[model samples]
Target: MTTNKLEQLKQMTVVVADTGDIDAIREFAPVDATTNPSLLFKAAQLPRYQSVVRGVVDWSKTQGGDINTQLINCSDRLAVDIGAEILKIIPGTISTEVDARASFDTQATLKKAYRLIELYEQSGISSDRILIKIASTWEGIRAAELLEREGIRCNLTLLFSLQQAMACADAGIYLISPFVGRILDWYKADTGRDHYPAAEDPGVVSVKEIFNYYKAHAYDTIVMGASFRNCEEIEQLAGCDRLTISPQLLEQLKQDNAPLIRKLDPARAEAATAKISLQENLFRWSLNENPMATEKLAEGIRNFAADQRKLETLLQQFWR
Candidate 1:
């Protein structure tokens, strides 16, 4: 039997490819794949996807709308186009993110998510195979709640705190992607330390807490640890519902024949105490108090929004 870490991990949890590269998806063969504006922007630069990018730009030219509207529409189609390609490689689901600039606007986020689904459906992909990725802000959570009721699943991204995770579980979201690497990055920058064993890793600790909370409460919402910095972090959360790993780390896991163990277990979570309820005001305050979560959440949104702009610039060049 193959004993590579990636294969070993699949035994305990669903493995997700956190990228927009079709070649990488084909190579890793993850159960699912996730794409955000950043990944999409980087993928667009690849020569193989140039035609796909041009196709969206050409379609935008035929549409009746202002330049800005056309640009937004084209970018939306571009993201889904990339997702549709990725869906072909992965057997399970593809998480396409909504515009980060709309993170604070529930209605706009809902509409954008709906539009992405519509595009996927038009391509013959069922809504069941699509998970609309959104930021884990209060408004984003509310939008997810509405979308989930309408049969559209959601993957809440940019998650940083237990408050965000609990709120997502409360909303009955299909999945929540708690960023592991970013949390570690925050702590590393603040404390001026770099070395952290898996047990001592702040990122690993956050995901374990969220995973335990979800399993303890028996909430159906899946906890997928995202933005991992190393293989150790991935190995630490071996029994998580899912882990969205980058192509680089996926390759690392593919090569190493290290033994992987289940760090998180449902039975362990079953021993956890009662669940905690969070009101809107309390959720807001809790997030604000966690400086790391607050700063990282804002930074993440800004980075994604910037990537979206870069994508727009690339589209404008092709559109013109």
Candidate 2:
């Protein structure tokens, strides 16, 4: 079966790989790809990436920081290096994340993003090779705004509420990864249930809310629905601007013989009424007001940061 869904949805959306697995990415053939610290952490443990880890180790040694400190820095460095390598295989960009610890520090997030861009540039990749990943926090949006003004683009991740998205578009950032899977997870965790059907899923409603709001307002910010738990969700969002699926789901999609439906349309969006924007304070307050987003955002950051540390440990072992 051909993953030719992209052709059908050509006018409506872009397809993106949401995996660090190069083989599956090659199989599905998404033009662009995205990776978080968690995915990179898992990929770096494979023997094929052992040499990659060693390369980081050797590079880390030359840098003159303490061994563990050097290793941690090298893990971040390696994520960008590996992402850039994947760019050579795909036709479009690779996303490399900023440290999640910097999620609340606008200046620190900006600096880390710049450092990643510089790494890509030094490796012969241009600004277009990468999208700096940042949490969709108030500080993160502020950092993305700064990056946008400086010609550095960003992918706002860990997003849930409509508030985070409107602010990103207002700031003219490149993309927003409104997580579909995680949104479902939040509802499941709270209500102890699943929202699998498009019409029934409040999670689907959340992303649709974001997508329509962006399109109707003429915002150029790309909405890439991410972290999908199942192909049902993916099928429902087939005509979104982009959908970033894991390699496992991509394979499942290829195996399943079901026909895909186009769920969203700009023409349809054009007919819907628009929504108003919220200022920074209002957006922050609204996000904080949502119990699910507030708890999940903090939890997501901590989990991703822990994976970053584990990735660093793997690199140190590779060096030895």
Candidate 3:
């Protein structure tokens, strides 16, 4: 019997399920799980999660707040409720995202993160078992830095450039999720090329660069390659510290019996000569210089924020 690719990849990287489907998480048994407002919102519409949504709605009514406040409260409650359920299935931590609208506000992000931690604590879950997900914006990084100091860990998401990764590292966050598929999508659209081999793939290149940079600097922040488009992309980054893959690709990997090659080596990272330290102005300008990163970063945030609003609207349907 040949070794399955999923099993092979597991030997080198920590597998994380990037979905809100409880059954999918159970089937894959990933080491960790991550969810965003969009995923939670999708799950809320399913018949199995109707009770989860209604439970939050009912609880929100008992608390004092306006309709908008009630909606926000219900959304947050539902996120943690879903997270709590996911935690029961996965032994590791869950990455519950803060509200995307608060992405640019450091203080708001901090307050919301604190609230999320409190909710988890109230439910008898330890703070160690949760990772607050935040955008990779400067403000978001600042908020994460503050939270990390107080013993709360965070996963910086929507990262598209080295500058973003470096900022997150400077903040000393627990993890950084550099999006791969999104970067590929941007390059494909811009260049009119639909096919890219793993070696030539812009997305794969971006992750490898970030991974090597992190290892070279000896930064403690874990590099998690996210938003994968295919199994080839996943296989190419076989030795990454972590890979949060969609269940679709995971299933694809399970079906393939092939030898997985470890493409990245920490030893090679020591040879990297490009090092950067950024001030506020330099960071902004550096990001601006990379048109792909700048556009994708903004687009990623806008899409997530839009999905968040959509999630809010879904909760409002049950308010009456």
Candidate 4:
């Protein structure tokens, strides 16, 4: 009997469900799950999560502040509540993101992260099961460094280039989510090409480089490939530490019985290489020089922040 690609992939890589749908989470039974503002915005509109939304709004109202303040509080609670629900299903950690608007503000990001963890604890969820997701901005990286010291693990997201990954490793971050699909999007738009072969795909290639570098250097930070365009991208990264995939692709993988091979191996990875230290100036300059990374990082933050506002607006309807 042949095993489905999904099962095979799970045997190697830690497959993470990248959605806010509880039903999908139950169906796929991923070991881990991740959610961002966009996913939470969509999940908030779902009927099953309506009660969760209402409960959070009700709680926020009792806290007492202006409507804006209440909305902010409610949104944070909703994200945590959804994450808590996800945690109940998965044995692994859930990556709940911080406000993208705070991406460039280290102090504000730290404050928000602390509050998020507190909310989780209030809900009886431990900090160990929560991965605070922050953007890969220099400020965000700085914020994560502080959080890690307090035993708060972070998922450094919106990453594109090696510089961001190196900076995260240097900061002792828990995990880094390299947006595989977005990198491919940039190259397609920039070169006016339709598609690239899976092995040669720019996104796949980028993750491979990051994976190899981290493994070769024996960095403790994990490399989780995120934001995939298709199963091919996931297949190309068969042995990644983790891959947070959307439900649609998860279903596709479940149906296909094709053999899956491990594409990345730490044991077979080349020997350790000389580590490069990335200070603020070099990190900023290198990111500035890489047009794709710079553009995608900014675009990702803007899109996430926009969805966050949208989520708040949706929650506002329950303010009555």
Instruction: RMSD for all candidates, in order, please.
Output: 1.1, 2.1, 1.1, 1.0
| lDDT (tens digit, per residue) of candidate 2 on 139-205 | 9999999998988889999998787888888888899998877778878878876545666676677
TM-scores of the candidates in the order shown: 0.98, 0.94, 0.98, 0.98
Candidate lDDT values, in order: 0.92, 0.82, 0.90, 0.95
Query: For residues 65-91, what per-residue lDDT tens digits would candidate 1 score against the true structure?
Result: 899999998999999888889887778
Clashing residue pairs in candidate 4 are none
Clashes of each: 0, 0, 0, 0
Give the higher-lDDT candidate: 1 or 3. Answer: 1
In candidate 4, stretches whose alpha carbon ends up further than 4 angstroms from where it belongs are 271-274
Q: List the residue pairs that clash in candidate 2.
A: none
Indicate the residue-level lDDT of 213 in model 4: 91
Q: Rank the candidates by lDDT, best first.
A: 4, 1, 3, 2
Model 4 local distance difference test score: 0.95
The stretch of ten residues in a row with the least summed lDDT in candidate 4 is 266-275
**83: Cα error in model 4, Å:** 0.7
Error of 4 at 103 (Å): 0.4
